[model samples]
Target chain A: MERLSPRIRPVWLTAAIVQAAVSGGLLVGGAVGLTRATDLADAVGLAESTVVQGAIALAVVLAVVRLALAWLRYSVWRFELREDALYIERGVLTRVKTVVPFVRVQHVDSQRGPVERAVGLATVVVYTAGSRSADVAIPGLRPDRAEDLREELRRLAIESEGEDAV
Target chain B: MSRLHPVTALTKTLGYAVQWASVPFFLVSILSGAFDVVRIDWVFSLAPVGFLLGAAYGLVEYYRFEYELSEDTFDLASGVFSRRDREIPFRRVQNVDVSRGIVQRLLGLAVVSIETAGGGDTEATLRYVGEGEANWLQREIRRLTAENDEIEADEQEGLEPDPTERPEPATAGTSGDRRPTHLFELDQVELGLLSLTTAKLSASMVVAVVTAFGGDAALGLVLSLARPFGGPAQLAGASPLEYAALALSSALYGAVATYLVGVVYTFVGYYGFRIGEAGDDLVYERGLLQRYSGSIPTEKIQTLSIVENPLQRAIGYAGLRIETAGYGPDGGGNQSAIPLAKRSRVERFVARATGIESGDFDRPPTVARRRYLVRYSVIAAAIVAAAGAAGIVWGLPYWYASALAVLGAPVGAHLRWTNLGYDLREDHLLVREGFWRRRTHVVPYYRLQTVSTRRSVFQRRLGLASLVIDTASSRTFVRGTPTIHDLSLSTARSIHADCRERLEDARRTRAREERALSVAFT
Candidate 1:
């Protein structure tokens, strides 16, 4: 099995931070809106300090948990290229092992998101001729490595053209 | 080059008129204050005109419809106003199915549905053609495909360094007079048994009758019958014994009626079921009123499914169904390759269909995976206990139902535990599963598109794994993915690896054949 780029940890951390920020903002914004619209603090018979402190503590704990899970997920994500197939093994709670045969692969491509671009990492996607769950993505690769993997897979797929993929 | 049978226009016209009648119904409902606040009566008069227009359109569409069969391609041109033409090469044609509805049967015509390797519904349907013509077309197409393969082989030999040597043993040894081989057929007694064992006899009808008149209508019926002499007051004063007797009789009546209806339906559907092999095509002819005949090239078969219900299993009988690429799209198309046969006969059919001998798949499956069975039964028992406790608390008689669960759990577990098995032969993998309706799927290694292993949260705890194998055929998805569940992790891993290796080998051989052909052509 091959491990992805080490830079992926920070990229995952950035994504987790963004997710935590958005969720925290939504929670606080919702509380503030309720208070303004209906005097929620007074109606609930609670002091403003109590409500604000509870929200802050909740957000902080959630953000910490999210960051930890992101790191764990980054560690578990791995992929390998075999002689006749490509295998991707990932997941934190429920592990998933996917294998796509070279003959069954329809195409391969590399994509980079904004954060991935900043972190100088790329993801390679393999589309297969399966009836369901037809595509698998192997993320957290250097752009050059991702490109090379894609090209190699494309050549293998072309060489196995007359094989019955179905 | 020719049109459909003259009777086709009548059937198509009726179909179109019925489809378009909805428009008139919508207009009438809206304008007559049936659905909204309006009161225009003139639109009611337009209903007749709408029907007439629909019929006219159907006639025009029928007139424009045309099909032409050339040497290597079948072309169809249809549509009333916006014409569309479709041409399918003989190589692309997968299977040809002939079905007849009541009207078509009455007119001595059949609907010929042409399927292709491209999935979805049949590529084209030549509706209401003479039955003989439909059979001829199917046979002609099969012959053409065979000839096409022969031409490719001959060209390859011409280009070979030594023309005398034939490399393919399978094709070389069997180039004799192509004759139809009678495989199996259902006799009167076997057909009766099969119809009796078929699961879910008119389930929809049972549901409909129960929902329609089960409660109030049943009570009213009892009361009305009782009121013939003394009216409602006397019936209200009836003894408890009388009510119990009435309920018992009604239940008996319902069950008997349901059984009779189911038997009649099964008989009609599979009256004269027969299956045979003609050259390279497997043919099926069956049905009582609306007889159907269909043929599928053996090369197009994706998987072989041997199905049996509990009753059939008890009597040592099974049904055979084969899945091709374009069959069973959106729950339509003929999927029945054989209606019913003895277990040994069905096994023979599987051998013929897969080219794997019966002895190869005779190895008993691993039985140590019964831990999954115990786990499932334990969960079921827990549910039963919980529900029974809740029912007791709520003052309901739950023991009657819980008794069923208690009896069912062990029986189900025993059946599944014993039946579930997987055997890997030289060229194919057979996975047998199901408790009441046992089905064994015979999938060729070359037909496998994907093979995966899944470990659920519970399976992980038990250190067990499941193998899910998928092919291109759609019927596999309908019956649930062909899976061999509950094996040790190491064993599952080894099996997965073995399948992958075999798949690679199959692909290499196919590629080599294609390369040889390409070199010959160039």
Candidate 2:
């Protein structure tokens, strides 16, 4: 299988970092509010350092885990286009392998989140018929490659449309 | 094509009255506490007036409902204030089911439910038609579908009917010349056997139903009733042998009671169960008090599953099930093809359903795969061992539980490894697996939407792979996707390649057929 583009590393890392920042920021903010408001702290029966240290530890753990996951995801994300189907493999802990046949493809679209756009990457989403978990997304492709893949899939799908009703 | 039976008005009114009955109980409960509600019965009596109003409304609604059949479509128009009209084409209809409940039976009426291609519950349900009228309507729809096919075929051959040539109405005389062949039917003995073997987890259901009807006090009553007979050891210092015999007899009594209950249930639900094939459709009829009849077209069937539970296998019998599009939990359709029959009978049924020669599925799984299963079981045993050790250290003496894992792991691994099997025919694929409920899924290549060989980190190290074959019918719980797991990498690869080629061939032939039909029509 062909590996996804190397630039995907940075795109994934940016997403993970943003996600960690939001959650970590919430915990730290809550801890700081508890520490500064002594009356509230006294009512809850907690000291300032305990809350502050726990929040810091949680933030550090989240940062470390998210960064490691991003790298692992980038390494594992791969896809290949066969004659009649597309194969995809991704996930760090629970690896998921998905296959989408051209005959069953209903539609395809290229999506770009703000972070992906900033990193000059796009994700192509393939919607299939008759399955709840059949949608396959190929992320971290350059815009041109994504467009090319989408058009090729569309053509293959049209060619096979007469055979399968869905 | 007309309005439903006249008694339908009464049934609809009764349904509405049931909903309104709760109001009186709620009002009485609320007012009995603070106010002297017992002194003023009229305050609690208003709910009857609500029922009367609902009954009057139902009469008007029943008067507004109407339906008619055109040459090519079934038209239903119903509503009291806002008129709604629906026209379903004959070509789009998939299966037609006729059902009757106790109330409908008393009124000599039935409910006809029509399901179409898309999974939208029921495309249309014509409620409470005369029993004879419901059967007539079902046959009429099937005849129309057949004629529509013939007309399309003729049109494709450049023999399009002139504008002056009006389509002929399907009458009793001109539907089909094909006679229906009697396929299978369950006798009293077979029905009893089926019931005895059926898995019933209905003890909880029995408890719940009794509680619902009798309130919380009934639970304690039931427990007290059973207490004397349930515990043989507690019955005054008896001999060990006597205690064991009592326990065995009680268990036997419970089993017999449960079996008798199941027999009654099956006898009522599956009375006169019969399957007959006419032309390209299979018709099934069953049930006693509430009868049901359904017709499924042969082409709509996606897969044929032959299943055998441990008991059924021991008795040399199996169950046959067929999956059609939109026929499952979401579709509100029944999928029972055959409840249970001898193995030979099942093979014949399979041959007839698929139009293929009788095939065998006796392939054994590989030894290497068994090793992997044993290794996985060992890891689980290790975890249990660690937990048991920890329990022992904590002074709970729970390490004895570890013996269960030590013994059960090997048996489970062996059953799983031995049960796995797959057979790839030229035009079809058969996958048989499961230890408790052995199932063989026969899928034609044309039905397959995707076939992928997957390998995980563990499989990679072992040089093993698994094949997943998916079809559109995966939307249903009864028709699951067939997966052939734990094969050598080379074998999996070859199977994948073979499946791909067969799928391509099926698609090409399908395209050619469509092209030929289109050309003939033009």
Candidate 3:
């Protein structure tokens, strides 16, 4: 099992920031209108003050929870290549284990977005047709490692197919 | 290339204007009617005015639309008041379907649909064109495409043929150098037989009629029928004799109606079904009133499936479908190349065409951890009992509902779990599914686009993972459940890794072989 390093937690932090910004903006705007309807000295029961404080608190809590979950996810997620198949294990509370055989592999694709590029990481999306939902995206891979893994997987797929053909 | 007639814009705009204007007219009518509570005469005047306006708008748009054509493209520039233009490339075209409505036929015009590989959203259509020009365009597109394919194939073979390899001796009589690439064509008898087995005549007719009537009329009819037959009241009380008589009469009526509808459906859907090989491509032409012709290059095919319904199984018939990269023009993701076929003949035809041996794949395994029928039966029984209970609560005859539910349990269960099987072998993966129409998809390892394994929380508890194999064709999805051989996570990971390695090796080998051949030839 190979786990993603804790340093990758920045991606989750970025997501949290975006979420908070949007939610916080809406909450603050609503609160501002409520405060305007009441005098600040007697604003204890003002809708604006309550709404703005509640929203900011919720955002902060969400960001904290997100950061904790990201840590757990990174620590739990592991992928290992065995002699004949590829195995992936992940999840915090509910464990998921998937094993894909080499012979069954059709193709492999690698993608990188700005966020991933900034962190010098890439994602690999493996697709299968057997199930309605067969695409699995493995993120947080170093580009060189991703390329190497891709080549290795391709080789295995062809070899297994050849063996089966015989 | 031809340009659209300038009048086309006028007609299109007129049509839109009519559509928009109807809203205001209807609103005014409703408002006037509301005011009629005070003065009824105003309502009468407004209704006629609205009606007249709508009719006038429709008439104006009807005669204004037109289009233009060129050697490599077609332009549809139509609008009245506000203009719009659309350009379609001939090369991007996948199918040219010509349809003649009664009105179009009377006017000596045909509607041409130009379909492309892009999903259904971007297709271009010509609402009305001269019948002669429509026919000419269809033929021209087909001819150009065929020529392009031939040239491509020749380039592929000529560029790489090894010197050590002996050139195939040119056949005598018909252009020795040019092999008559057309390999097979279905005559009327074959086409007729094929249609007999796979054609859902009634379903086709329903679809055609619904399309003809448009969406609203179709929805209205469905709602009318479903209102009475659907829901708990359907299973309610009756004496045995009365129930039997009702069933008998309904069955008799249904049989007669179905047969008549089937005839119309078959006639309309598959009026002139034809399958032939043109160069290296398989060309399929079908339709009753609207003739559609499409061609698929052999190389584009990812998988071939042979499906057999219980009725077809008894008659030794099958349906042949080819899975390709793009969505099919006729709505279905998988194209029915030979909609209905003789099982034996279709197998032989595929083998000859692809140079793949017949009977190379294994039948899906029948044995499983448990009999699927038991699970199906249990679920069916539960559903029936629940329905019967619901009926009883609704003040229906409990005994009658109970009897019907009990009788339906086995049948329901059997249908649910029927024909679920998967088999993995060397070279290919085979999956057979579907209760009524048993379909066996044979996917070659080479054509696979992706391989994946998934496990739900429940599956993980059972120590099972589902394997999925995908191809370029959107239709084919093969999944093996319960983790074949109870493969462990590490084993599965390694398997995927190995598969990826093997694919690369094969590609390298193929590339090396082609290089060697090229060098040898030079």
Cα-based RMSD of candidate 2: 8.6
- Candidate 2, DockQ to 2 decimals? 0.20
Write model 1 residue lDDT over B384-461, tens digit each, in one string. Answer: 877665455434343446655656666666667677778898678888888777788887777777677777666777
List the lowest-lDDT window of 10 residues for candidate 1 chain B.
Answer: B513-522
User: Candidate 1 A-chain TM?
Assistant: 0.84
Ranking by TM-score: 1, 2, 3
lDDT of 3 by residue, B203-269 (tens): 6556555445777664454334434433222335744444444444444544555555665555566
The DockQ-based CAPRI class assigned to model 2 is: incorrect
lDDT of 2 at B167: 34
lDDT of each: 0.71, 0.71, 0.55
Cand. 2 Cα-lDDT? 0.71
Task: Residues A1-166, candidate 1: write the lDDT tens digits.
Answer: 9999989999888889999999988777776676667766775567766777777778889999899889998788888888878887776655667777888876788999998999899989886544443437888999999999999999988776533344
Tell me the spans in candidate 3 whose CA falls farther than 4 Å from its real position: A1-166, B4-14, B27-123, B126-263, B360-371, B398-428, B456-465, B476-522
